[model samples]
Structures are given as C-alpha cells and as structure tokens.
Target: MTVPLVFAAVFMWAMWDPTETLEDLPVALVNNDIAAGTGADRLAAGDEVAQTLLDSGALKFDAVDSDTAKAGLAAGDYYFVVSIPSNFSTTLSGIGGKTTAPALISITYNDNNTLLASSIGDSVMTAIRAEVVKGTAGSSVKTVVAGLDELSSGIREAATGSGQLHDGTSELSAGASELAKGLQNELVPGTAEAADGGRQLADGTGQLASGLTDLRAGTDELGAGATELADGIESIVGGVDAKGIAAQLAALKRALPNDPSLRGVVDELTGVVDGLAQLSSGSREIANQLTDPNADYRSGVNELVAGSIELNDGANELSTGLGQLNTGAQEAATGAAQLADGANQLDAGAGELSAGLSDGARQAPELGDDVAQQSLADLLATPVDTKASNVAAAQFNGPGAAPLLLILLTALVPLIVFMCCKPLRASASQPRRMSLRTWLRRVAFVGGVSLLASAACTAIVWVALSPSPDPAELGKTLLMVAAATLMHTAVIAVMFAIGGYVVGAVTALAGIMLQMFTFGGVWMIETVPGLLKWLNPIMPMTYVREGFISSFNGSPGFWSALVIVVGIGVVATGVHLLLVRERAPHDEPLAAGSQPA
Candidate 1:
C-alpha cells in the first residue's frame, strides 16, 4: 500500500510538472462584467490569462461570483480577485482593441499576505489593461497565448523525449537480444576463453614479477656498491694531479716489492717529495680509473650490454618463429584432417562403385538367368565394368601441449641446474675458499657461465624458430630476454646461497602473487585501483615486462626497460656477492622474514 501511494505521488508529480504550475497557471472561468460595458470587455481578457494560468496547473485561480468573492475577501478566505467594472467588456469591443486592454481590470486584495496579494492584484490589473489594446487579448489573454505556445512546445518536447526514450529502449531491446545472441553465439564460450586467458596472463605475470623482484634486489646492492666506488674515485682523483703521474709511480715502487703497475705504472714512477705524495698517488690512480671513460670494468659492462642486444634479437626471433610454427602446425593439422575426410569420402564412393559392380554382375550374360535369351542377345551385349577398391586407413599426426611442455622442460633443466651450482662456489670449502683471489675467480666463473648459457639458449631458440623479424628489432628482443633471464637467475641464486632454498622460494612465491593480481600488463592495468597501480612499480615484473614488450616491437621504450633490467642485474649480483662475503654462520634461513627483537 505504501509503495502504491509512493508510486501515485511520483506519477502526479511527473504529470503536473512543477515548472508548469509555477510558470503558467490555470484559471476557472468567470464572466461577471456587464455584457455591454467597457469594464466587462477588459475583464474578458483578464479572464483569459487567468484561465490559461489555471489550465497549465501553473497557478490556481477562481472566478467566484462577485457577491461570493467580496464576502470571501473580507473574511480572508480568498487571497485576491479581479472585480470587473460595468463597462469593462464594451471598451474592448470598440476600435482601439490594439493598445487598450492592459489597464482595465479593477483589482481587490488583502494587504496582509503582502507578497501573495501583490502577485494576484498585479496579475489581474495587468490582464484588464491589455484587453482594450487587443480586444479580449489583454495581459491575461497574452499570458494564456504564451501558455498555449508552451503547451505546443511541451508537446514537441514530449515527442522529442519519447523519441529519445524509444531509441534508448530499442537499443536496450537490441542489446538484450544481442546479449542473448552473444550468449548463444559467443558469451559463454568467450567467457570461458577469457577466463582461461586471464589465468594464463596471471601465471605469466607471476613469473615475471618473481624474476623482477629478484632483479631489483640485486640492483639495489649494485647501486650501493657504485656509490662506494664513486666516493672512492673522488678521493683518489683529489689525491694526485694528472702531472704527478711519474713521481707518484716512483714512490709507489719504493713502497711496493713489485713495479708500480697497480694503476698508472711508469707514469707514477718519477722522483717524489712529500708524505702526502703517496696517498695522493694512490688517490690519483683511483680517480683516473673512475674518470676514464675507457676503464676496464666500464668497458666490460658496455661489451656485455652490446652482447645482450644481439642476444635479445635472437631470442625474439626464436619466440616469434615458435609462435608462427605453432600456428602453421595447427593449420597443417586442419588441412590433414580435411584430406582424411576427402579420403573417407573416396572410400564411400568406392563402396558405391562396388555395389554398382554387383548390379552389373547380375545383368551379365552368364551370371544372369537369361542365358538362352542372352544367346541371341549375346551378339549385341557389352562387356562388364569394374572399379578400383579402397585399402588405406585414415590417420592424423600432430603434437599436443603436454609433449611440448615436456620438451621445453628437458631443454631448460641444464640451465636451471647450472644456475644452482654457480652461486654456491663462494661457500665451497678447501682451496677454492682460501683467498679473495679464489673467491673473485669463482664469482667471475659463475657470472660468465650464466651469461654464456643465456646467450647460447637465446641463439639456439632464435635460429630454430627463424622468426625473420627485422634485424634491429630482433636484436633488442634477444637482449631483453637475456638480461631478464640472467638477472632473475642471479638474484634467485643469490637468495638461495644466502638464505638457502626457503628464502628464495618464498620470495619467488610473493613475486608471483603480486604479478598475478596487482600488475596489469597481461590484462587492463587501468582496471586496477589506484592502490594497486601504486604498488605495481614495486613488482620486479613491472620493469621486465615493459622491457619485454618494448624489445619485442623494437619500440622507443627499449632503452628505459634496458636501464631498469641492467640496474636489477647489477643490484642482484652485488647484493649476492656482498651477502656471501659478510654472511654469519648462524644466520637462519628465515632471517629476512624474522623480526628483530
């Protein structure tokens, strides 16, 4: 019942639109003026505006009996009224119907309800005055005419609104039908397909994130080491000027058993004087190394990067080729299936041919029961026909996903195992762990192995796939892959070395979780909330994935991704080395996760 009343109220409001009530008022008809009087004529026009206002429901008015109205006005039962004088109607009928109607209505009102009273009195008087000017077309008539115009306009507006609503409804109806059609044609299946895609994207992103996190941790360490290196360089360069190269060298020789071959050999060997000279010479060497664009380590880094670019191209080509081959094989399988279908059809035709042969045999002269009759007919008889038989069975050959996964696993196992071993060299006992030199050798060896493995795998996959991507684009792709893979491996391996399998495993899992849920590369990133978007940068996959996309397309974004990748790699490698060097024997596997007391 409440609901019905609420609905009724809403309907009423809609029908009597407030604007209509306020802007135009409906008036009840009242013909009080004497028929022949000018006052009556003027009052007629006043009546019209009142009537129009009444009809619009814009305002409410009553043409009460004069006797009744006067009584109501005195008793305060009525707000106001238009009292037409006796000659009111006669004036409007005369020739000056043009400018005479506006001033004729004699108005009466209570002054107490000041505002309401003013509006009523003013409106009535205005209508009467307009009447003499435009016959009965006084202010009220003009207002009514305006209201009539509004009515027409309202009708047009209603039609426009209805049209829009009709279109909207039609669209909605079509959408509903299409929705049903989509359900029938694609929605259900597409949803399942999209779900599967989402799952895959999630998984891919997870892997990327884990890889990236490991890389980022590594980069942080590398950055720390770099800061230290830069500081040392500043100290060294401050120690000696470029001109003191020989004298510095000579002093360094006296302080050392060997020749002054530490940094600037012969140049630092000239005669020297002060105590600050030695420190200065040493500082100069450090500064020179830091400042020189062609320093050994920096040059090596550049070379490594260049090699990475080549590697990236190769990897991209491989991935692309592999993708194409997968597509082609699918097509080939379909073609083979079609061929098998054709062969089956041929076999069916052969069976029909065999049936035809049987029919022909029955009509053959000797085989038929008409031998005697055939003796006369034999002279005109034709030889029997025969057709070939079908003897082959249809077969289909194609690979499925499982076998491919297995093959992939088999190929990657060596690299994975190699990564596991390379990082453990630091902790090895005996001569291997005897000195800093030995440790350095181990680090270099492992780093070299990881790099070589990455390059070789990239090359193999690229060559095998033969993607035929543009060379430059292809190169960038391979570099991205190699950089990402090596960086991830180093970071993960470092974790394994520092905290054992558990720490590495946990980090890997966390990375995967973030990748699947937070980052948006595999799906619409913008769909995620602001909080997630903010968190996205923290995921290592964010950087690597972007780099991968950039590299894949040979887009301008390649450099940015490359920088991030390298940064992660450096940090990972540095942190791993530093942790291994400074590790305490009692540090637990869960140390990072554990809160200090």
Candidate 2:
C-alpha cells in the first residue's frame, strides 16, 4: 500500500506544474547589436528585444556579456543563452532596402542541464521572432499605407486637373470646329467670289483704258480744229473794214439827194452798209477770242487730253494689278480650303482627347482620411487573427500528468499484488474438478484487492495533485483505473500460473516496462522507437492511459479504450483458465495434505 502511494507521490511531485519553475529558470541574454540609422531615426533593436523579453516574465534572464553567457551555459549556470548580433538593428532597419536576408536572433542551449531547456528556449525564440516580425511588418505596412494615401491624393488631384483639362479641350474642340466650319462654308466661297470679282474688274479696267485712249485722241483733234477755225475767221475779219464801209454809204446818199426815187435808193443802200459793218465787228471779236493764247476753250481742251492720257495709263496699271490680285485671291482661297480641312481634323482630335480625359477623370479613385487609412494599414499588416478553443485544457503540469501517473499506478498494483500472492495452489490431494474453481477464487480475490489498490492510488493522486474538478469525469477515471487494474491482474496471474514464480516475476516486470514505454506516458507513441511503436497497439496499458486521459479530460474515446482493456483482460483470463485446466489433468497425485510447489 505504502509503495504504490510513495511512487505516485514522487512522480506527481516531480512533474507538478513544471512551468512554474520557469520563473526561476536562469537564462543568459547577450546583446551585441549596434544602433541603426542616424540621430532621431536611430533604433537599438537588440536593446528593444532584450527589454521585451525581460518584461515578458516568461523566464529569468541574466544580462551578460558574450564570453560570460557562453561560460555560464557550459557550466550549467544557464539553461540557454539568447544573443543578438551586431547586425540585428542594421538588418531589421534596412528591411525595404538592399537587405534580403532575415535578421537572426541566435539561441544557444546546453542539454547537459536538461534537454527540455532547449525546447523551452526554442519556444521563447519563436515568440520573440513573432513579436519582432509583427513590429517590423506593422511599421512597413503603415508606411506603405501612408504612401498609398498620398498616391490616392495625387491621383485625385490629377483627376481634377484632367477634368479641367477635359472641359478646356471640349471648349477648344467646339471653337476649332466652328472655325473650320466658318473657313470651309463661308470664308472659302467668299474668297472665291472676291477672286471672280477681281478678274471681272480687271477686264472692265482694260476696256476703260482703251476707251480713254480713244477719247484722248479725239480731244486732241478737236483742239486743232478749234485753232484752224479761229485762224480762218481772223483772216476774213482783216480783209473787210467796217469804218470804210460806213463812209462810202454816207457819200452815196449825198449824191443821190436831187430826186425822191434816187433818195429811196440811197436809204436802202445805207441800211445794207450798216448791216455789213455790224457783221464785220462780230466776226472780228470771234476771231480774236479763238486766237487768244489765254482763252479758256484752248486751255481746257489741252488739259482734258493730258488728263485722259493719265487716266488711260492708270487704267492699264489697274487692269494689271487686278489680274495679279485675282491670282493671289485664287491662291488664298485654296489655302483657306486646306486650313479648313486641317481645322476640322484638329477639332475631331481635340474632341476625342477631351472625351478620353473626361473618362480618365471619372475613373480616378478617391481615398478617405488619415484615421481610415491607418486602420486599413493595420489590417493589412496583420491580416490573420487566430482564436483557440481549449476544450479541456489543463491549468498546470500536475493535472496534465495525472492520467499517466494514475495508469502507471494502476498497472503497478497487479505486479505488487501478484508478487506476494500465488496464482495457483495445486496438490495431489486436490481433485481436477476443484482446479478451475480454485483458480477462479484466487483471481477474484487478487482482482478485488488490485481494484481497491488502484482506487486508493487514484484517490491519493487526486487529493495530492488536484487532477480534475468534475465528479462525473473523476468517476469515469476511476472506472478506467478499475478496468486497467483488472486487465493487469489477469495478465500477471496467467503468467504466474503458466511459468511459475521466477518466470512470472521476470515476465511481469518486462511487460510493465514494455507497456509503460509504448503507452506514451513519457513520450508520444509516434515519437518512440520502431519496436515501441509496433508494440503500442497491442499494449493493454496503452489503452488504459488513453482511456484515463480521455475520461480525465471529459472527452471521447473512454468507452473504446475501456472495451479494449476489458477484452484484453478477458483473453488473458481465458488463457489462464486454459493453462489451469491443462495442468489439472497432468497433476500427479501428491501425498495427501502435501502443498503444491
């Protein structure tokens, strides 16, 4: 009773709340990292990481130099040593720069102290890595998000500018189109008409020049005719004198004064002479006026001929100028037509440009405020958030190890009981019929005692370690213990019955070792050696441990494990029965009252 209880107590005490010892577990921390960046941007990544680990309270960390840390780890003063190299800060700081390799946090551990220490160190390093990655990645993401925000703003501004440009281009296209229409529909035809008019005017001017030349020649002839007429009149006036004619008329009248008829003749002749004198005076005045150098008629005819000649020369020049102008106008009209075509193309191109710019402006994105941007950055930085549901998590190492210890204790009970109690008591006086009955009775007695011992060990473990709180789970655990105890008891009994004391003891011890090794109490079955893994399926204690753990955790698999355990127990019991029956027939008659060996 004391032996099994003592074993349980020792195992529970050793394994109880192992993590609690981490608070005092000494580890070395060495920071050889230099600061990165300049002035205000300088960052001491090593110091920061050290501080984080120190604050985490995960383990007892002793800040030490490199040599000291190494010596301490070798001498078993420290379980593990975490060292930050000089490039840690520089490498981490240069994340987006040329640095492609990851910043390393070196972990050195000494398994001489405890192999578990190395595992613990690995776990700690993993946590440190995660924290460092989170900080660095979050910062990088924030910067990227901020840049994205700026890019968004720039895009929005560009969109606005594009919209304005589109509006301006739209107006320009419309104006260009109107200019092209005016040039094509109005200016071109007008220029052509002007060219036609110029041609017509040239022809008219040429005709006018010819007419003016003819008029000038006629004027010159008129001037010469006027002069000749004036000269002829003057000569006639010089030939006849008016005064002489008047005197002759008077003398003729005096001679004819003697008779009345003669006097009538004299009066008529005097009138005639008076008329002749008046005619002669008028002719003389006309000749004088025509022959005068300063006369208005002669000067006017000369001036008119000179003006007509000048006019003729001007008309010829005008005709030549009109012909040149007509040619120029024709060229201008052709240029205008080409310009109109170019303007029309320009209008169409500008319209398309405007439409394209407008579409681009409409398609541009808009980003919100700083707060929203930051939230998005954080989300992108750490996209996944994990949640764990620990269904039947153990709070401490003691409770977690309770099932293994309990199963071990239960298995040991049969070994302890069978060590003192004999499985078979045969004698020559004992009849063959009593052999089966006697074996049954001994099995029942041993099994009952083993069950009691298993329950007592379980109670001791529960009271000492506080393995579980649920009454139902505890009851199931007890049931698993009872089943395991019965199975072990049957196995030990059969071994003793078939092989006797020495063989039974050796077989029971070996079976216990095999079961314990393969049951995954110390290590997981998958992690065990090949032989152990193969034996794990057949080991009754493996199911016992499984059932115990299942029941303790209030999970499934208890019933299946219980069934397998009971079946193994039944098989062992049947084998024991068969051995007992076979031996019953072979038993020689021992002297009456003599005990069986």
Candidate 1 lDDT over 1-597, as tens digits, reads 343454445334333222222222222224455554354343353455445435543335666777766555433344455454544444444312121222244455432111223343354434433332333323333343344344444545555555555555555555555545545455445544555555555555555555555554454466456556656665655566645665555666667665335534443334332334554555555544434447664455445555555555555555555555555555555555555555555555555555544443333323123343333232112111111111110111111111122222222432354335523423423222224454466556555655676667555544443232222356666666666666665566566565444444444434444454444333233334445557777665566655544443233466887788678778877776666655422222323432211
TM-score of model 2 relative to the true fold? 0.37
Residue-wise C-alpha lDDT for candidate 2, range 398-456, written one tens digit per residue: 34446666777877888888776544632244446436666566678788888888888
lDDT of each: 0.45, 0.64
lDDT of 2: 0.64
Best by lDDT: 2
TM-score against truth, every candidate: 0.26, 0.37
Q: Give the lDDT of residue 579 in candidate 1.
A: 60
By summed lDDT, the worst window of 10 consecutive residues in model 1 runs over 390-399
